[model samples]
Target: MAPTQYSQPERFRIALGPLLYYWPHATVLSFYAGIADSPVDRVYLGETVCTRRHEMRFAHWIEIAQMLREAGKQVVLSTPVLVESDTDIAVMRKICTQGDFLVEANDLGAVRCMERRPFIGGPHLNVYHADTLAWLAELGAVGCTVPVEMDGPTMLALSAARPAGVAVEAMVWGRMPLAFSARCFTARHFRLRKDACEFRCEGYPDGLVASTGEGQAFFTLNGIQTQSATCLDLCAEVSAMADGGIDYMRVSPHASGTGEAIAHLDEIRRAQRPASPSPVMPADATPSNGYWSGRPGIGWVAEEAGT
Candidate 1:
């Protein structure tokens, strides 16, 4: 007998990545509760960024995972990106060892500890080449997210070249997560150092918007992270993505109306609905889909409702 080649079932699936900001504990719980009743196929639950944002602890994540599982949804735990100390690595070990659902390995450290259980290769893991995908497969990577900067054609090529049994995912929605940093940009903006930042990043429900020379919102200085000012919107390109071999589309979390966001994605994935131009208008937040165009992630391309 030979190994089976990977095959997608010819349908799109929406996955909700872990909430990136530092929201209140109650907000986190109620958020997942809303997702439990939504139509997203898989939901990633865990902190993928700074370790200081302890509002959602390991146990809380596990509890949420169990709740999502019980609600008939697939769950994956995402590990943090920058592991500055042994304590963070220890937490990573705990998450990998839990063995409840798929663990999304955001860095090589997490991959090293994920013993044989099929895990997801988060975008933080530089997965540009087919060989990288192959290497991760050897370590039991079941699915992997392509970096946000890669254009559609480049992503299509990668999808075609993926190793056997591996699925390729992309962050089609939300502000483009450009890079992570050792210093906290948000804290500095509020006149505080990293150690005593007082969770100021939480204040920006989206992110601290930074603009260009013309005072236009260009990017955001998040806590040890940099994100595009405009949320990456791919509402118009979901069909084209389905045409490509991309398997899953990830919608990163914001502060409010995440359930509605997940539901809209489910509509497109199921083909039970048509593509809409504006995403959940007047919902206290807006969307941008220009990253899929391969231009500057913030650049917007206006399309008629169903172009």
Candidate 2:
């Protein structure tokens, strides 16, 4: 597919996606305190994963948002991906009506609550085609974060057909969130009941790595969300993304090295040079960009190989 021409700023915005793992209350606060000075242009706050991992409450998130905003960063609150109960619905409603910051609607319920109000469509919405993008734009989606599984050609096609005034954002870094379940895998792994899971996920600040029978790293198990074992590093594709009409690039938060990742991307975006090897990956995790290359999600295709 040919690249599309869309109205975009001079530089592609760098966004920090919401925290996906549970952390200690002080750790969460310190993380954002560091992020307040990072190069990220936009920040997505709030708990998007399991609600049981509540080290920080809604009020604390708002306080952090205000602090980040004070630091001259755009702040957006993210709604939970799975609405399993009435309590979840009520929380989603609260996020949609918060009125202070922009909201990223991760589910249909959030979209409904945000009708006629501007929002950013979260990646879990599975908006693969232009029609779905337009439908969302009509319902007040100022931008849409395309699914992490979407390929480059598909993104270009969707960008070409996107409605006016709507922007496209893509996940450029971190482990891809593959699936979510009602059952808490982290809890189950520890042989605990879902209701009485004891918040064991807190122990894995970056999610527990699950290996295959042969002991190959496969997936990272959070409470309910299953993520890729390898982080997705698309810093090398920054130019291609800008050319393909992607306005924003999101970097998912890690327990550590998030600032370094942001700085690395900042350098690449500013210099418009080829990206160096990412410095933020944990010692055990490798980098993968297979989904961007139309390969297996776990596969890694080198930049030169793609060319």
Candidate 3:
């Protein structure tokens, strides 16, 4: 195993990614209110999935950002991944123009729009190469969230010679975002049209799980995003990542146990060791870190004892 980097605790920040799944207004507000006191150093706000979700408007997101900022957490507003209409473009423009906090650019158009302003390159941006990362840095990107599919060695390779002042972040826990489409999958699951989804996704705070033919949990369906049914657990790999130049570990929000997850990661960072294999998962749960080891995304590679 590699040695841990960063002699200072402030160098490695923990981030809470934007809520990918839609929850009611009260639930969303309440989630962040509690998160305001979490051990996290950053909080990403805004709807990154379906644009039709109005439970929290731009103003509401701004309010949440301000609240988190006041609590001493760095706040970044994330843009939606699959922007479709003129309205989407308008909203993206509005977010980029906020000028108060950093914006996480989900679309290439967002990258083009945010030129000359420091921004966050979201995981959805497909930033796979050092050159691309450097280009984004040249465009004023100060940090980037590495895609879930990018493995440790690849991450090391990218970070080894990455542009100066550009920080690297990786998803350390939660359902891995696999893909996004123009179609509304959760609405389709309930036999509803995209235009009239009736907000079916609201019923599933985490996401609707789609299983295999053998009844094994497989994929998670959000409005338009397909995520891994099995939550990705890289808790055991945090030390290695820290050693490899990762500056941040992001915990994707779930309807339950988010705080506990953040607390556990903080504990691991402080102790600089592997956490006891995460609270026993469900029978159908398939926790994985193979992608981090350069294998198939769903496969788990166990660590040898006392590395």
Candidate 4:
């Protein structure tokens, strides 16, 4: 009832996506603790990246969602894109059965199962354009996370065709979640079996960065998923995204501090005229915004000197 601070009087929104890696339950709790007090309007909680990364279960996820709700944040449970087992479906069913919180279906199976339930169809679902969005909206998809590879113009065009009150979101900061695989890259790299790998991924706060043979930091090996090593900074590009009809902007949680990332995105959503400093590119990541420009996703063009 606080007038929905995010884009209420403005034109854009900021949201926190589901944790993409397997973090300890305590770390997850603490991260949301800070987010609940931050400037973000919507917060999504659930494990959608890997089914094996389990420090928290259905009960725990529900608890965390409750906590975020108590702190005045909207909560959503995200289903796995590649559900490989009965247990995976079971857990996803539990999340779907929660009924109260909104659900973000990441895969086709989830979409099919969530018939007429008014959920958020996640980016991993690969919805692009008016027909796809219209189809999803018909299935009770109230919102859809714009795929990371989509450019501002395309997203804007898609928004112009979506259903009424249906929202579009963009990833504004943090490691870009590029792809997911069935094999645990970290465990395999360490010469271990997927089931008995001791969950080595939990030790990495930001997931392991993998470079290409040409010495380029191409992606991150996070358990069974591969993420771009570079943090996607849509800060300078926010205006274009907003104009493109993006309703919600997303910031994925890195190991260090998620609050700052969320706050920075909040500033952009509020359309503050003054600019902010960009992320310091680490050796492993040459940050780029080319995806917003409609080129290759990794291709980034420098912003105007003042922008």
lDDT rank, highest first? 2, 3, 1, 4
Per-residue alpha-carbon lDDT of candidate 1 for residues 1-307, written as tens digits (9 for 90 to 100): 8732222233688888877887889988988898888877889988777888888889899899999999999999888888888878888988888866889999998998987678999998989888899889989999999998877788888889888799889887776788988889998888999999999988777778887899787777779889877766676666667777788888888775555666776766656566554355222334555555666566666662245
lDDT digits (tens) for residues 160-258 of candidate 4: 888897888878777777877778899998999988989998878788887889988777888888888777777666665676688787878777646
Q: Global lDDT for candidate 4?
A: 0.77
Residue 184 shift from truth in candidate 2, angstroms: 0.1
Instruction: State, as a TM-score between 0 and 1, how close model 3 is to the true structure.
Output: 0.93
- Which stretches in model 4 have alpha-carbon errors above 4 Å? 1-9, 275-286, 304-307
For model 1, how big is the CA root-mean-square deviation?
A: 5.3
* lDDT preference between candidates 3 and 4, better one: 3
Candidate 3: minimum summed lDDT over ten consecutive residues — where?
A: 275-284
Q: How close is each model in CA RMSD to the real structure?
A: 5.3, 3.5, 2.7, 4.2
**Candidate 3 residue pairs in backbone clash:** none
Q: Using lDDT as the measure, which candidate wins?
A: 2
What's the TM-score of every candidate structure?
Answer: 0.90, 0.94, 0.93, 0.91
Q: Pairs clashing in candidate 2?
A: none
- How much is 249 displaced in model 3, in angstroms? 0.2
Candidate structures ordered by TM-score, highest first: 2, 3, 4, 1
